[model samples]
Target: MSGIEELDEDRLGALAHKLDRPLVLIGLMGTGKSTIGRRIAGMLGLDFVDADDEIVHASQRSISEIFDEFGEDYFREGERRVIARLMTENKGVIATGGGAFVNDETRALILKQGIAIWLDCDIDTLVERTSRRNTRPLLKQGGPREILTRLKEERSGAYSRAQVHVVTGDLPHHETAMQVLEALEKWL
Candidate 1:
């Protein structure tokens, strides 16, 4: 659980020095993208912006509310707009929604502007992590394993397309963040 445990420190440090802007965190619901993105941004002394949060701000409604009132399609379109705006801003860490990467336009937009890090985690771990929260609309039914299975099948390919993939099931948030930075350091 040590900070940045999955990555070689020397390589990440070197990459951190050369970075021109904040990195982007992309992955499934419970992969710790928001938690770890904030930590990584703090470590690098950069701002952190969660695209979902931005979406909420612009719409003046929570994600759950959006899903409840406007349905998934509207929420998703709003997400695309929020992500597009976030990408255009100055350097700042960004954490995208789970569904955002699945959209062709959103995926292409992220790939073009930022270093996308996929916080890969096993289905069990994702289910466990997400179980503690109620903000997820897709997960409100049936069982966790079933939901995970569907999500994995639907988004695995898009997630795999990330510039850097960091496994995070057994690691703490700090360690995961470090690993992401480390892998990205060498990658960039």
Candidate 2:
């Protein structure tokens, strides 16, 4: 199993079967958490959940609307609740919002209930990917590169507490997912 295309299905299945808890992906925005998480869940025969999507569903509003109507504090509180509920209900691949892991309570909950994996990436890649969309709340305040740089610095310590760390580059999503699988193989 040198590469994703050459990976042995039986070996991959065996590795997935060995997992005892949910795999929670924590990272800055544009780190490919949602994209890679879905692939990992499919590979492992588990469910895939995006925390922000769940938050939107629960709130019945867009994240921007939630922020505008309720403020970030309100949104964070709701996010914490939604994550706790998700963590308690199922063992799967959970892609969290960028700020979710930065919150102490949410981070503690994730650590307690799941195997947290930090999908780290360089600032250039983050900026490039994030620039494709203008939906990010944090980026709305400033340039993507500047905002992402500050976020990386501020949240690096929190993200470092994850159980596994997978460095992502400007590669295909499957390649990054394969790296996560390799990290999980070592971690488990």
Candidate 3:
């Protein structure tokens, strides 16, 4: 959790006060949105809500199970609703599912009601990170690299509309969060 530079708490407070809406993170999976969002929220003294978790809670099923029981379309509809509700109910950091922002309604809602930050990383890193989990329905059918690569190509257009874009390399999660904090400072 050690970062290269010590974060300035006073600066974080100032930035947090400047926030007008939720900080919504949009990206492909394995981009560290949940982890970095938690760090950023802690640093800013804000709440952290993972939209995926909310979806699971509301549905009473895991994401993969939801996909298995219904389908991607059904899951997406629920995801949009969940994200919209979160936007209205929480003025904090929100980490969205990879495909959530691809939904037109969800994308529009985030762009209008929150500061969207897109986190991206290389395919190799994505494969490695996503390998740790077996819960991703999208990757369940194909090779993770191929699915992830195609996902990036298809979703980059929507994700590119984010207010801020950060590419995370081999940095530690804390450093990646620091980068997001710096980007937010500059954007705000």
Candidate 4:
């Protein structure tokens, strides 16, 4: 589909059927991965799984609680394991935690077993979007702008390795979702 208007559910489902691996979204926090993943799943008639939510479910604790209790290294190990398991067990769209794709082991596994899509966003946009939520443990440690900027810079290299890259912005979620769908059309 060229645009949202041209996208029909049947057409989306057809594209989804052509997919052989889980579509993993890699990006910094507040890049609309979860929201857009859900939209993509609904459009494609595929199941949706958020890696962070799955991590929460598997650990029986909030992500903040995990980080606060066990620290980032411990939380990351669990994240890597959780993501690896999700890759094998899930065949739909997976919206990963921001740091998930940045880990060496997790990035390698995702690259091998999943179709990676990098949802890139500007530092300004990230700051604005992330402000809507105060539960981000990383942001709690420092200023959101500085933290997000450093994160976007540090993670860009890993994210660039994704099979497909979509530069997203402050547009409506559906517009971005349609853009992703259109990109996947060319991809799958």
| Count of steric clashes across candidates, in order | 1, 0, 0, 0
Span of 10 residues, lowest total lDDT, candidate 2: 1-10
lDDT tens digits by residue: candidate 3, 54-129: 9989999999999999999999999999999999999999999999999999999999999999999999999999
Better of 1 and 3 by lDDT: 3
Residue 21 C-alpha lDDT in model 1: 55
Q: After superposition, how far is residue 145 of candidate 2 from its true place, in Å?
A: 0.8
Clashing pairs in 3: none
The lDDT for every candidate, in the order shown, is: 0.82, 0.90, 0.92, 0.91
- Where does candidate 1 clash, by residue pair? 4-175
Runs of candidate 4 exceeding 4 Å displacement: 1-4
Rank order by lDDT, top first? 3, 4, 2, 1
lDDT of 4: 0.91
Q: Model 2 scores what on Cα lDDT?
A: 0.90
Better of 1 and 4 by TM-score: 4
Candidate 1: tens digits of C-alpha lDDT, residues 1-188? 34445455565456667776557788889989899989888777678999988888888888999999999998888898888888888477899888998989988888888778888889988888999988898887778889888998889899899888988866767766677776776687
Give the per-residue lDDT digits (tens) of candidate 4, residues 1-188.
34667768787778887988999999999999999999888878788999899889998999999999999999999999989989999899999999999899999999999999999999889999999988999999899999998888888999999998999988888889999888878777
Per-residue lDDT over 110-174 for candidate 2, one digit per residue giving the tens place of the 0 to 100 score = 99889999999999989989989878888889778888999999999999999999999977777
Output the lDDT of residue 1, model 4.
Answer: 32
Ranking by TM-score: 3, 2, 4, 1
Residue 72 of model 2 has an lDDT of: 92
**True-structure lDDT of candidate 1:** 0.82
lDDT winner:
3
